[model samples]
Target: MFWWFERSGEHLRLEVLQLAADKYELRVIDADGTARVETFANADDLAKRQTQLQHALSSQGWTGPHGWVM
Candidate 1:
């Protein structure tokens, strides 16, 4: 899955995918090209982290968790 948020002129994207039987990852990329990747042991942990990230971004004035499956 993929998601994005924008604030002012800055944009951010997040991509989530499974790595293996018990592994998942969330990759974050910014408009300027900086990127970060996080790994989780399972979907539950990945989901919790994604939620936290969304809340943090929202508090910072970013708009839309607008996303679609890839």
Candidate 2:
């Protein structure tokens, strides 16, 4: 799933995808559209990081859909 946000004239994108068995990837696009990728060993860790990012963005006045918990 993917969530999009905008704050201070910049765009943010968060995406989650399953790469393989028990493996997942988190893709984040920063304000300048710089992409960062992280791999998670489990769903729980991914969920935690996703929540953290959501909170951080919300605090910064970002407006978008909340992340989907897998």
Candidate 2 residue lDDT tens string, 1-70: 9888887767789999999879999999887879999999999999999899889989989987545655
Question: Cα lDDT for residue 68, model 1?
Answer: 97
TM-score of each: 0.93, 0.83
Q: lDDT of all predictions, in order shown?
A: 0.93, 0.87
Top lDDT: which candidate number?
Answer: 1
Shift in Å, residue 38, candidate 1:
0.6
Tens digits of per-residue lDDT, candidate 1, 15-59, equal 999989899999999878899999999999999999999999999
Give me the displacement of residue 35 in model 2, in angstroms: 0.6
* Backbone collision tally, model 1: 0
- Top candidate on TM-score is 1
Quantify how close model 2 is to the true structure by its C-alpha RMSD in Å: 2.6
